[model samples]
Target chain A: MRNPLTEAFGIEYPIFAFSHCRDVVAAVTNAGGMGVLGALAFSPEELEQELTWIDEHVGGRPYGVDVVMPVKTLDRDAGIDDVSDIGAQLRSHISQDHWDYTDRILTEHGVDVAARDDGLEEGAGLGAGVLGWTAATGAPQIDIALSHDIALLASALGPPPKAAIDQAHEQGVKVAALIGRVEQAQRDVALGVDIIIAQGYEAGGHTGEVASMVLVPDVVDAVDVPVLAAGGIGGGRQMAAAMALGAAGVWTGSIWLTVAENGSSPVVTEKLLGATSTDTVRSRAYTGKPARQLRTAWTDAWEAPDSPGTLPMPLQFILNSYASQKMGATPPRELVGMPVGQIVSRMDQVRSTKQVVVDMVQEYVDVTERLTADLEG
Target chain B: MRNPLTEAFGIEYPIFAFSHCRDVVAAVTNAGGMGVLGALAFSPEELEQELTWIDEHVGGRPYGVDVVMPVKTLDRDAGIDDVSDIGAQLRSHISQDHWDYTDRILTEHGVDVAARDDGLEEGAGLGAGVLGWTAATGAPQIDIALSHDIALLASALGPPPKAAIDQAHEQGVKVAALIGRVEQAQRDVALGVDIIIAQGYEAGGHTGEVASMVLVPDVVDAVDVPVLAAGGIGGGRQMAAAMALGAAGVWTGSIWLTVAENGSSPVVTEKLLGATSTDTVRSRAYTGKPARQLRTAWTDAWEAPDSPGTLPMPLQFILNSYASQKMGATPPRELVGMPVGQIVSRMDQVRSTKQVVVDMVQEYVDVTERLTADLEG
Candidate 1:
């Protein structure tokens, strides 16, 4: 029961559940393993409210905050209030045909349209310009996290900037970065990252070029620090494999997205359940990064011949966010592709987050036992 | 150039260039990249003769022989020369319909028919059991190699058996094993394999479940021995990436398969030249192992609904060798899926093996210089 990773984090289990919902984070942390709230979708004030709620609900249990401080963002200086200017730039980047196609699709889906703001086509339903592109958006969110009882700060994108790392270290908070390459692992180590997450392309959400089964050891070798295997890791078998491959722990995301305590839309959960190993792709259509998502009709449309290729970072994200939300809210919802990985195939049923963590540990124990027995035999 | 790999082997270059042709082995060893003669198709006596000729031509530059020593052979104890017996067992394992379909396809393709040794089925060309299928087949070839000044014993399958490793070490020859997983690297270490070849599934021939980009570091982490990155590595950029990922060197197969020094069938060489990155598939149809080969009509046929699923290990290999041979001899080469990796896309034309190695090293230097400039800037 004494997970090395949990020991490292001073938590009950190595399970660091990544979630967008404050309720899920609070529930997971209270259940023992750390719940790391995803701060990419939230504004500074919204993140503050969520962190406060988690601080109250977590009952003094340790938790973490995840921010998207990608090393490469389209517009690093865009702020929330002044996003309209960059939003205008993004509008110019999008073509009229693309706009018409999006409108037609939303109308065909019977989505209730909000009245368009006349003065600015830039800051429409989506947030203003390049503000959504960079980690600056997460700066205030990081401040909110620092104010809470957060034990760790993880960057979902590239390594957190040197300043961010310094600030986190100053606060006595552990810093971790998700990476897909050995070079990135070395860079993270040089950047003084406490943990290197070698996430494979098989993982849900934004991912890099490598697969988890191969990336973990590469990262472990490139960095002296401990590595948590992410991507394609969902069950005990993968966890055992990761450990066998020299990972300190396994960091999973998709396995929790459809759990009983997950905040994922019901339609999205259903789609995830129906997906197989091949039912996902790395696309920048949803976010302006290579994210592994369920290969849905929406993803297919983005890949189709006629549609303009996806816009870069904030521009693409802004153009698609409202339509994505509407699609997430619909039935026969093949259009909306939720970020999931190859592990989606194993997410057959919904279970409580606590049960999921417990089962993973139990499964790990069983696998080791079986392997040992086989080796001895 | 003082290539470390060749120096390690007391050869010209570190490159252990794999080729089915004896002429290529002599040429590469003479030029630089130590040509490793593919002994799969050659009889023990023929292999000996080939090695003798290479020794005569390369002026003792340390050429080696490569044989298929698949771990999962048809019957582990089935003597390599017990062609009729093994063929009977292999045929029995496959259904009558499968055999009939195989026959029909071959006959349709204008393949010449010959009465099989057992006369159980009249199939096209010769029986398949004569080709390399087990360690038994490769053992004689190894013996032939040892009779020469061969410095390295490389296994195309899983880690060579303890006896093979011991035998090679006893002879002052290094034993190398190709691994696609971290656990396999550990297994190779426990088996006392002197070299761990972390070949990604993207590599040609029998590969495991991980890609090279991930496998190299994982292998490096799992073993103390020098690690070589195989799969998806063809040119200088990939070579740099492999070293960046902690590999001591690159073990390339596809790159050599197209070199002018390589005497690959003109048909096969052309296919490799024109192919793109997307033209390869990891299918078990060719060698009873998950090998990356050109996505050809033969591969399509093997995966079709009416076709029988491939048999396991040596049996599947026994059932397909004649077909492979016929494919090799044909024009426009239908049913001929040349074993290759994702790196095949980068192979645009045939060049001398030595020049290829030199270019790769030079390109690696250039790429590093560009990267360093970017870093400093």
Candidate 2:
């Protein structure tokens, strides 16, 4: 599809795939769609190494970098110079009562909260660097990302700061912000975002209650820039729906979670494949904000009446860091969960990212052709 | 626009406008889109009169009947012979404390519970013939509707009972059922439903949590029958989105609430027109199930912790019946509300139903052409 998205990003298809795994990124980029790597998961050094590997493997195709620099995140307005200052502030805010409650819930669920030594040894316990919640840390990541050749920069929660936007624009990297509400879309556009990813409530992580059908057209109407539709978009039909709602393209995340190159744990992959759409819930247990995820024992426990409430944003991430590492590495790994959209029900098997793109484009073409015939006749 | 929905219903556009008022149904049907009158709001005799008025005014255009024959309702399996029997059973189940709480909340909000004499005089209080909820009630409505010249019949909560389906089919009227989940789509298909209304969470009235972007494709894939996408479809962009998701047509409800031909009160229409997507909530306070409605004092009061919890289905309706009539017709009318989709945010003015249909078709044509050009390029 040769929409503005394809032309702006210089890709063959308008499908922009987001994944944490470099393998999926390289595969998608090489397959003619833009592959956006979730760079918040990697440190500066690790990100450099991963980018070098991708540059070597991608054959000079266009791809993007996704960073988590929420405008209203914890310590966002602290005017901090260093990531360490923000980390210290974040740690100080999480009460001991919340920590004790986490311990109680994890222990009750037979999760090995006691095996947190490995996390501390690996410096996983909250300190200078945690999940990319602070702009202080995210700015460095952006600097690292700009140090490389990338096509787009996508901010998940809100519009990236002026410095980040300007820096990306300097490198010819078009900037995008994902928004759940029309007001956010208007703000993002006014802030000079090149693209607005209008994600509906059905999306995987950090979603609002507005569904895509309503949210997409609202965002499209509110913004001057081209929009990319996200949330519950996995196939060609959904991509076409996005276009019908006046979006230039589709920004996909959950569909990549089970791709053969995604490199998620086999247990997690199997659970996702077997899960139905009803098996998911919007829970704040993981990220301290409402995110659609696989309903698991871990999420269910946090929702119970006896359990303590979750902390907000960075505090919740800080508290979750210690136990999250253990849960992934533990035996059985029953409580292991990740953010996924309602489209997980459709991801019944593992396929190459290339095949996924090919199938989607083909189906999108056929469906559109049929619709055109219906319209004309 | 010339899909199976058009062919099956003998309409020009594949847009099915649903409203309780005869004026809207007649106006929409005369304007080339099929207008399905919501028959649940009227008794058999009243519905006959409404249908006769529509038939006289609609310029020989086709229309349909929407009966709320939810397979499982409050008194579904009681083998109830009449609405009185069901209403009596429903009243018996509602505790006196609950009634007192309802009375207290309404009076405190300046709603006159004693001013419902007009409703009693007009036969608005529950008795022999109420809105469609049971086979006993819906069957008679179906019989009356079949005696007319409707082109389609639809059930809301579940598959129409075998008798209803058979009766509709016998008259060559196609049968449809609205579904919120993929499982419900399959069940409806198995019951030989001709069309499936795959409504998403953004829809007004009783809806499930699944949004249209996910639910539409899931339902379209699960069933072999033609699917009509509903929920948040107030304009052409959303209708285009539905078609892209493999829906044969678009079933709309909320957009009609503010139409010039709709008979809703000016206060409720003003609230709907001024509201945003966030102003509505899926609360059990209204229909004893999660129904999206305008968040007025009535719904807010029932949701408050100090307020008594809502009784299930018919009980809640029975309890609210007295106060709701007063709240609508009395002086203040502050607590007046109605079912509306998230697209209620976009319904900023009152337009004639003909303009709505004409605008939708034109927009649909322009969008499909743009998408086709994009795909071809």
Candidate 3:
């Protein structure tokens, strides 16, 4: 708890709660731990309003905003100025065979997205925005984040953009990036990132094959920066494990998804509540990247041998975004999932986010006391 | 610290050090933590001698014996009653194509094994004992183990046989089994295993895909029995994490390989000291089963395309065991390597087994003190 994360962020504890809901973020900060809001699905205007609301509610307590800016992306074209422009590029690149494959799976599940959408990109189920992959989209989001009195700016996909890093540093906001490998962590430190969030394969969303037990200490040894261990970190024992591996704190996302005030769909929450740690699989169907999600019929179909290969980045997001949300479908779970760590199975209850944070801190103290007794004896 | 592991074993600390060397086991027990001697490399007679040595030196300090009694193995013939019978089955089932492939790799690397031993089934580099894969071999080792006044009988690969568990309990010795998944832990508990070793993928030799952070808690939640955390556990912080995840103690193996009085070759120890966490790969090249080992040319060749696929256990082991040892080569590292965990990177120096135990306890105290100070503040 006396590590770099608590000291740098000026927080009582280093338990990081990652969620998209503004309420959860404000609540976690109001408690001892820090809250990080995921901004992938947010428009600049929407994100601004959300941050504005969070600032007012947090009572000057620190919170962070996470943006997905992958270093390797499909929208590399400098001319792409907007999400629509990226969508146009995406529509042009995805082949008919891929569409047929996605459509066949959706229709078989009873969604029939191709027929329902009427050739428009508009879909009812998808929340909002697409392709946070490019800097064109992520830059404006960073501008909005810097405008707010945020304590930290987190990049999910890869190293944060140089411009984003400079802007955050200039605004006195610490910059952090999540990495799955030791090489990426060294690169992040070389690029002057303030913190490295070392995520393991058991984590939700995009991840690498290395587990946190190995990756946390590996990243910690390879670089001089502080490391926040992510993936499969849900409770006090996991937070203690992170610190044992030389990590400054724990960066958790999946555990927050089941919290009472979470912004995720009820379908996801229900699936998660009944799930075990082994129920999650790393599937590329949700987005172009290989992200860990619940093993639904959707994930099984996309992984089947006869299915079409996934499109890269924005193209996949653009082609299957509507279907992914299963907008207006009678059954919500036909295509509803999000990135979550292997810790999903332990999330069987709907506790308040504040309770989750409080329990973790208290459990950490209790566990340490138990361990220290043996050490002293 | 004050959990089932200590209560069941009467050890001051719940740390369990797993090693093939009896000296290291004796040292660990003398240092307050429990030591477990791995019996995979010993014949019945050799094992008896080793156990006798441990008993004489331990000053009545309790210790455990670990025998690899996998539930399913390549040698499945119930009528086959001996190691030579299994060896005959192994020799017949192996294709010459495999022998030629193994020989070719060795010869090309300047390690011609045929001329040195004149077709004898022995080599200098691979320590000792050919097969620990089946009950045919492991039962005899267990018989030797039970003859000694051991405190515990631990099984690896799968659930311990009912006969073994019942006999151990009848003899007033506890039975423990190592598991990598929640289902395995439940099955072990149902079978009345005295303790569960929840080993993550970060462990050496045989392992499952789940990490310690996720697997430990999942297993802890599933079973009411005592649990020991293994894999990527070389120090105190990891011990605290295991306790947090509800494990009674930490079970470690790889860290002992580099200890001053270890049984492994100095060549392997030097390689381990110089290696990083990513330097290991889970390959069936050495043992038929996928055990993590130093990433060498032998492992790479077996894992690569355009090569003959690895043979099944006992069969593949009987055919190529001699060649893999690399009896004598100038470069030394032509094919020599040993089983190790991803925690190899942290073993930057070689210390006494007693010093490691002392340091771990000290570091555990330091970490908890730091965490508790913040919790109270």
DockQ of each: 0.04, 0.76, 0.44
Write down the worst ten-residue block by lDDT for model 2 chain B. B121-130
Model 1 residue B128 distance off true place after TM-score fit, in angstroms: 13
The CA lDDT at A270 in model 3 is 82
Instruction: List, residue by residue over A1-377, the lDDT tens digit for candidate 1.
Output: 45446776677656677888876787778777788888877777778888888888887888888887766655653432344355564456567776676666666666544434343343453552235345445567677777777888998667777887898889889988888777877888898999888887567888875555345645665688888888766666566556655566667778888877777777778888887655778888776677888887667777776767776676667657656544444534656678887677677898888788788767756655543332233
TM-scores of the candidates in the order shown: 0.56, 0.93, 0.89
Evaluated at residue A165, the lDDT of candidate 3 is 89
Model 1 CA lDDT for position B252: 75
Displacement of the residue B329 alpha carbon in candidate 3, Å: 5.4
Candidate 2 Cα deviation (angstroms), residue B126: 3.0
Q: Rank the candidates by DockQ, best first.
A: 2, 3, 1
Residue A352, candidate 2: how far off, in angstroms? 0.6
Q: Candidate 1, which segments miss by more than 4 Å at Cα?
A: A1-4, A77-84, A104-132, A325-328, B1-377
- lDDT by residue (tens digit), candidate 3, A16-127: 8788889999999999888889888787889999999999999899999999887776666535566654555556667889878877887787774644555465432223
Which of the numbered candidates is closest to the native, going by highest DockQ?
2
lDDT (Cα, tens digit) per residue for candidate 1, span B1-377: 34335457765434556777777677766776667777777777777787777778888677666666666665674444564444554555566676666666677676653423333354422232334555545566777777787877777776666776787888888877777667777877888987787877667777664555445655676689888777766666566556555566667777888877666777777789998655777888876677878998777878886777877776556557645544344533676678887667678888877778788767655644543332233
Give lDDT: candidate 1, residue B24: 68
Looking at model 3 chain B, report the run of 10 residues with the lowest lDDT sum. B119-128
Question: Judged by TM-score, which candidate is best?
Answer: 2
* Quality of model 3 by C-alpha lDDT: 0.79
Each candidate: RMSD to true structure? 14.5, 2.8, 3.7
Report backbone clashes per prediction. Answer: 4, 0, 4
